[model samples]
Every structure is written in structure tokens, then in C-alpha cells.
Target chain A: MAILEVKNLSIEFGGLKAVEDFNLSLEKGELIAIIGPNGAGKTTIFNMLTGIYPPSNGTIHLDGENLLGRKPFQFAQAGIARTFQNIRLFSNASVIDNVKMANTADSNENFFESILRTPGMVEKERQLDEHALELLSLFGLEGQADTIAKNLPYGAQRRLEIVRALMLNPKVLLLDEPVAGMITTELDEMAQLVKELREKHGQTIILIEHHMNFVMPIVDRIIVLNFGKTISEGTPAEIQKDPRVIEAYLGGGFHGNA
Target chain B: MKNKLNSILPPVVLVLIYFLIQLLLSKKILNPYHIQILMFACVNIMLTVSLNIVNGFTGQFCIGHAGFMSLGAYGSAIITTMLFGGMKMDPNLRIPVFLLSLLVGGILAAIVGFLIGLPTLKIKGDYLAIVTLAFGEIVRSTLRLIEPIGAARGMIGIPKITNLAWMFFFVMITLYITRNFVYSRYGRASIAIRDNEIAADAMGINTTRYKVIAFVFAAFIAGVAGGLYAHLMTFIQPDSFSFVKSNELLVYLYAGGSGSITGSVLGALVLTIIPEALRFLGNLTNWRIVIYAVILVLIMLYKPSGLFGGKEISFLRINRDSFRKPFNKFNDPKLADKQNS
Candidate 1:
């Protein structure tokens, strides 16, 4: 059975169809990439998937449960976690705090328990600190845990955002343009990190990216979008040769490298 | 044992300070006038710190805090004066009654805060500020039309039941709760909302719920402060909680450093005392306003983030070592080499 199934998902912004009849059946542990040009409704699709934007028409099912009409936080609680296209760290907060903030839904302490500093609350807080530190260490960010998030280098900020999203322990992780502004070295590292995240953690993932080189190596399957419609869907080899995808996106100058 | 000491230390220090003030008052070293100023400072501390939760930590713009304070003032005044005014009760009983009145007023304000926050918080930035500003004006105007609480003429003859001890007690309570809230998971959520609401929402935090919670909590504290203010002055008036009063609380919050609890306390205390202290200039007292303005301008120009600049004093911090330990580990050569590898 598919872990996440979207049927005929469509959204219109003021009579302009942003995403039309988008459909997918993602199995557990599968990694897919959505490749598109600028303004191809890639981020808008992500927004709909995470409940940030309610689709004009469609149904989303996570583990057979319908998720239409739910709020973004509810979507997060329902195991759909995502990182923004533009990095959105809690800039003023410390690095550790940015990660811990994502675990708020997991905290069981009530207002009275927290304010009164009950024994259980103290224990929970200590555990939270330890857990946050462990996740930070995985990304080599533990050393900078005390630094304000915005003060970190750009690559570190991008990595920190992924770490923050991972704290949610989502069933399906959606990353929107995770390496938009990365240098070559940072891009390779991010590619390696994303590959590791899937292999080691068994995290089922869907990502939107414009970096063909970055997307070609890491993703198992590719879905090409153009003008708010799916232009192609296949493995990397098949997608690389698709004449329609070549003409619309890769262009005549393109040569298959993979 | 060490943990126990750390837990008990703050309250013990507060108690000692309270007793010292009491001693000074009894010896006449601190006159009634001085005591009045101290009480006002305590009340302002409560107002400023509570306001900090919404405007500072939660990152919401709320300029109508005085509206909640007025609700609390009126609510408590109605309880102590209108409901229980005629009885010649025992002095000991009076304390409990006053405490109950304050609690009632606080709860009343909290309910109103919750009501107003639900719809208003959906809007962002400048629009929210304008709505809150208008809310304050609406509250003030409505208070004038009500005949039961003396209407526009104001309610008078309320008993002066608030003493230095009571003021000190509430101040400690306000500070303790604010400190604890800021450090807790819920408090972290509020800060997250302040930092980036969209990110916080995507992180599974119920943004609207937390925003309303902060608003209601701040309103409750402001209401309690209002009750204290009403009892201290032995009168209740709508004008006391005008937009100017709300702006004064904002000045206290910002001028002291908005996000820091210690900054709020210091801002309220220092700003409140400076105006009074300048009275010693006598005929030159007119120049005192000029001096105060200059000090404010200097602080803004030199340290726009306020005195503490989002940093807390060590005594008020819950996890002082957490920040220092990471920097030490970062500087260690072994860790740097491991990361490089």
C-alpha cells in the first residue's frame, strides 16, 4: 500500500490554474524529485502537500486517512514535514532552540506543569536538550549550538533547516529547493547528506529542485513539471532522454551525462 | 543538595529584600513618599514584564495593554468597593478579600484578552497594531458610558488596602511566573512564533493557540497590576488607563530591552525613579524633562536594542551554563579536527 496518495490535486489562484490534476502514489522509503523551471508551481505543489495552501480541488491521503481541509500545523502533526524554499530559521534563537522548537508537538507538559517546574517537566526538558544536541551533531552543528541561527554561514543555515524539519519525525519529508544558493562544495555535501538521510534513516522523501546534477544523482525517480502540468515521469535515464522534457527544459544544448 | 539550593536561592533573596525594605520603612528612613514610589515601580515592573510576553517574546505588536489593566482595575474595584464595601471586616479578612478581588480582576481581563486575540491575531504587523490601538480607545470610550462604576466622573472612596508587602509579593509572583514561562517548552513556542510565525506553524506549533495564550496571559498580569494600582490610589478612573498609559508601558518595555525579563524590571524601575529623582532640581525641575528626553535619546542612539539587548542577567537565567559550554566545545582543537575530517 502506498504511504501517501494524492488524487487529482489542483489549485487555482484567481482563475489561473497554478497546479492542475497533479497525482502521485508514493510508497514507503521511496525518494522522488520534482524538477521544474521557475514559476512552474513547484513550491505551490509543496505548499498544497503540506497544507499551507488548500487545493482548489483534490484529495490527499496519508496512510489511508484523508487530509483535506486541515491546517498546516495539522498536516505537520499528521506526519508531513517540510523545509521552505527560502531558508526560514528562527534567526534570533540559538541553533539548539531552532531544532527544539520543532518538537513542541511532542512535549506532554501542560502550562501548569511547565510554569511550576514539576519533576516530570524538568526530566522532559533535560531529555529534549540531549535529543536536540544529538541531531545537531549529526549535521556537525553541535559545536555551534549556542550561536544565533542567522549568524551561521549560509550552508550551515541550510543544513540547520533540514535538521529542524527532521526533528518532526515526519512520515514523508518534503524539501523545497534545499540547495538553491549552495556553492559546488556545499551542493555536493548536501547531496551526500540527503542520500545518507534516506539510506540510514529510511526516510521517504520528495524534493523540488532546479539543479539537474544534484537531482540526477540523488533521486530514484524524477517527475518533470512545466506550465503547471506533468511533462514527464520516469527514472533518471528515461527522464534524460524524453524529447518533450528536453525541448521544454533541458533544451537542444543538453547532453545526457548520467 | 546543590540543585535544591539553586531552586530555593531566588525566593530566599527576595524575602530578605522585602524584610529590609520593611525595616527601612519602620525606621522612617524610607518615608511614605518613598514607599509610594517603590510600590509604583513594582506595579510598573509587573506591567512591563507581562507586556514583554506578548510584544517581546511572542513578537506581537500590542499597544493596548493599558486596556486590560483598566478592566482589571474596574473589575477589582467593583468587587472590593461595590460588593463588599459596607462591611467592617477584620483586618486579616481584608487581606484575603483583596487577594480574591485581584484574582477576579485578572481572570476577567484574561477572558477579554482571549476574546480579542482570537480574531485580531490573524492579521499581521501594522494592521494588528492599529487594531490594538483602536481597541484601547474603544475600551476607554466604553468605560466612560457605564453608569454603575461612576461613569465618566470616576469611582472614588475605594479602601487603600495595597501595602508594600502585597506589592512585593505580587512582583515576585509576576517575575517568577514570567521567568518560568520564558524557559518552558510553551515559552519556546512563543519565541518561535515571534522569530518566524510561518516556520513555527510548519513545525507543528498551533500558532493561533499560542498567540492567544500569550495574549491572555499578558492580559491577566496586566489586570492584576491594575487591581494593585486602583487599590493603591484608592480610586478608579478610565483616564488612568488611556492610550498614553499604554504607550508608557511600551516605552518601559522597549527602553529597558523588550525580550529580557531583567531588562523589563530595570526599565520600569529606572524610568519611574528618574522623573521623581529630578524633583530635587527645584525651580530647575522644568529642565528635568529635558534631561529625561536626552537620556532616552542617548540610549536609543547608542544602544538601540535597549540596556541588556536581549540578554538576561545571570540571576534570572534558568540555563546559564548551556550557552557557555557550546562555545568552549567549539573552540576545542579536537572537535575542530574531527569536523574537518
Candidate 2:
């Protein structure tokens, strides 16, 4: 059964249509990649799916529940989580604390518990801290937990973003340009983490990626977008041979492999 | 063990020093006028430190801080005046009553904050600021229309209970609580939202909930300060809690550096003492206001981040690295075990 389903999704800003008739279904523990040229509305699709923007039309279902009108945070609580294209790691905070904030949403902790520091509160905090650190360690970030997020190297900041999202323990994870700024080695490490995140954590992952090499290896299937609509959907090998996919990337004049 | 101590030491030391100095100054060194000036300084510290939680850490501009203060002052003053008005109680008992009243005032102010914040959560940046400022004005006008509290005549005969000890004690508590909060998980969420709301929300943070929490917490502290102010001045007036007073507190937070706890404390202390130090400009009170304006503008132009620029300062070493030789590693297995378990 599909874990997340989007039907006839459309988004318009003022008079302009930014996304139209976008549809996709994600199954449990599956890794799917959405790829397109610039302004193909890849990010817009991610935003709408994550409740950053209320869709102009259509409905989204998470675990068979309607999800069109909920706020981004409400979506998070409903088991949908996302990370931004730009690295947003709470720059002034320590890396470990950055992930710890995500754990706060699901924990049965409150202001009184934190301030009073009762035995229950202490135990809860300890468990949260451990979980957060384990996530950092999964991405080889345990050593950087004490450093200020912004002060870290650019590659580390991007990794921190994924680690933070994972802290929410969501059923579906949405990543926008996870490999946008990484060096090749960093991307490879990120791929390993993403693969582990799916296989071990059992999270269904949807990523919007421009780097075809990164997407081709990890994604179970690929969706192609062009001018705010889904143009093609298939396995990686099938998407690579589609003529429209080439046109979307390099205009109609060129003939090349995707 | 050392790592745990490092996280909790600064706020403790700062509060201890504040009370120690208050005790020493009251006993032998300072006169009543100086004591009054210092009392105001403590009040300013509470206001600025609390304001920093929203304006600095959460990145929300709140021009309604004085409204929260008015609610707190009125809430506590009415309770104090009504309860202790005609009774001949021991002077010592008044302090506890005053503290209790302050806590009550803080809670009420937090409720008002929640009410205002509910409608304004969707608004951001300058627009949100205008809404909050209008709330402060609304409170001012409403107070003016009320008659039982004397309205324009001001609420009078509030029993004076804001001694040096009480004022400084609340100030210390405010500082300690705010400092601890900044280092905790809530603090990180607040800063994350402040740095980038969109990203914070995407990371599964309930941004609206955290924003309301920060605003309410800040308002509560502002209320406590207002209570102390009412008792210290021995008068309560709507005009006293005006936009100018809010501006005064904002100036302190901005000049101190937005995210630095120590900076807020220093800003309050320095700004409080400056006008009195310039007593030579007696009839030129207008010049004092001009100078204050100039100083604020100059600081903004010269140091946009203020004096400390969002960095913590310590007079003594608190981190374990200070004692451990060659301790440059970013992570320690032992530290990780301690944090986890």
C-alpha cells in the first residue's frame, strides 16, 4: 500500500501557475527521486507536499488521511517531514542541540518538566540526547556535535540538515537538493546514509535532485518534471532514455542521454 | 562531570555575584539615592533580558513589551494594595507576599501574551511588529478609559515592598532562568526559528507553538519587572508604562548585543547609570534624550551586532578544556556516554 499519495496537485501564485497536475504515490520504505531542469517546480512540489504552501487544488493523503490544508508543522506531526534546499541548520546553535530540538516535538516533555528537572524529565532528556547523537554518529557527525552549526564546514552543514530531519522519526522524509553543495566524497557518504535511512530506519524517502549520478544509483524510481507538470515516470534506466526528459533539460534542439 | 558543570555554571555565578554586591552596597557603601538607581538597573536588566528572548533569540520584534509590563505591574500592585492595604503585618512577611504577587503578575501577563500572539502568529517581520505596538497602545487607551484604578490619576497607595533584596532577587532569577533556557532544547528551537522560519518548520519544529512559548515567557518576565517597578516607585500609572519606556528597554537589548546574556546585563547596567551620571545636564533634560538617541544610532552604525555581537563572555573558565591539557578533540567517547545516559 502507498504510504503517501498526491492526486491532481496544483499550485498557482497570483495569476501564474507554478505547479499543475502533479501526481505521485510513494510506498513504504521506498526511495524515489524527482529530477528536472531549473524552474521545473521540483522545489515547489516538495513545498506543497510538506505543507509549506497550501495547494491551489487537489488533495494529498498521508497514511490514507487528507493533507491539503494542514500547516507545515501539522504535516510534521502527521508523520511528514522535510529539509530545505538551502542548508538551514540553526546556525548559531550547537549541532547536537540543533537535532535535539526536533526530538522535542514527539517527546512527552513540557516546560515544567524541563525547568523542574524531575527524574522523568532527566531520563527523557537523556534518551533524546542519545538518540540525537546516534543520528549524528550515523552521518559521521558525532565529532562535530559541540561545534556551532554555522561555523562548521559547508559540507558538514548540509549533513546537519538531514540529521536534524531524521530526529523527527517521520514515516516519510522529503529532501530538497540534499547533495546541492557537497563535494563528491560528501555526496557518496550522504548516499550511504540515505540508503541506510531507508533500509534500516524504514523511512519512505522522496528527494528532489539535479545531480543525476547521485539519483541514478539510490532511487527505486524516477519522476521527471517540466513547466509545473510531471512529464515522465519510470525506473532510472527508462527515464534515461525518454526523449521529453532530454528536451526538458537542454531544450528541443539537443539530442543527448539524460 | 566537568562537561555537566560547564553547561550550568555561568548563570549560577552571575546571580551569586549580583546578590553579593547588592548585599554589600546596601549594608555600608551606597546611599538611598544610589540604591534607588541600582534598583532601577535591576528592573531594566529583567526587562531587557526577557525582551531578548523574543526579539533576539526568536527573531520576533515585539513593541508590546511595555503592555506586558503594565499588565504585570497592575496585576501585582492591585493584589498587594488590596491584600496588605490596612493590615498591620510584620515587614518581613511583605517580601514573600510581594514575590508571590510578582509570580501572579507574570502568569497573567503570559495569558495576555498568548491572547495577542494567537492572532499575530501568521504575520512576520515589520507587519508583526506594528500589530504588537498597536496592542500596547490599545492597552494604554483601555487603561485610560478605566476609572476604578484612578486611570489618568494613577493607582496610588500601593504598599511599598520592593526592597533592594526583593528587586535584585527577581532580577537574578530572571537572568538565571533565561540563561538556562538559552542553553536548553527550547532555546535551540527558538534560535532556529529566528534564523530561518521556513527551515525550522521543515525540520518538524512546531514553529507557531515555539513562537508563542517564547513570547509568553518573555512577557512573564516583563510582568515580574513591572511588579518590582510598581513597588519601587510607590506609584502605578498608565503613562509610566508607555512606548518611551518600551523604547528604553529595546535600546538596552540592542546596545547589549541581541543573543548575549552577559551583554544584556551590561547594557542594562550601563544605560541605567548613564543618565544619572549626566546629572550636570539638569535643565537640559531634552539634551539627555538627544544624547541617548545619538548613542543608539551610533552603535547601530558602528557595530550592527552591538558590543558583544551574539557571543558569550566569561570572567572565569567553565569548560573542561581549561584544565585539561591538549584537549582540542571535537568529541569524546566519555562525554558522549555522559550526554546519552
| TM-score per candidate, chains pooled | 0.93, 0.88
Tens-digit per-residue lDDT, B1-341, candidate 1:
44456668877887898889889989989888998999999999999999999999999999999999999999998888964678777777777889899999999999999889999887666666787788888889999999988888899988899988889889988988888888888889999999999999999999888888888999999999999999999987888889999998998889999999998999999999999999999999999988988988898899899987699876567762432334534666665454335
Tell me the deviation in Å of residue B91 in model 2: 5.6
DockQ of every candidate structure? 0.55, 0.42
Interface RMSD of each: 3.4, 5.0
Tens-place lDDT per residue, model 1, A54-99, is 9999899999999999999999999999999889999999998899
Worst 10 residues of 1 chain B by lDDT: B320-329
> Per-residue lDDT for A256 in model 1?
32
Q: Which portions of model 1 miss their true places by more than 4 Å?
A: A255-258, B1-6, B23-29, B82-84, B320-341
Which digits, one per residue and each the tens of the lDDT, describe model 2 over residues B43-127? 9999999999999998999987999999899999988988888777778888788889998999999999999887787576676
Error of 2 at A185 (Å): 3.8
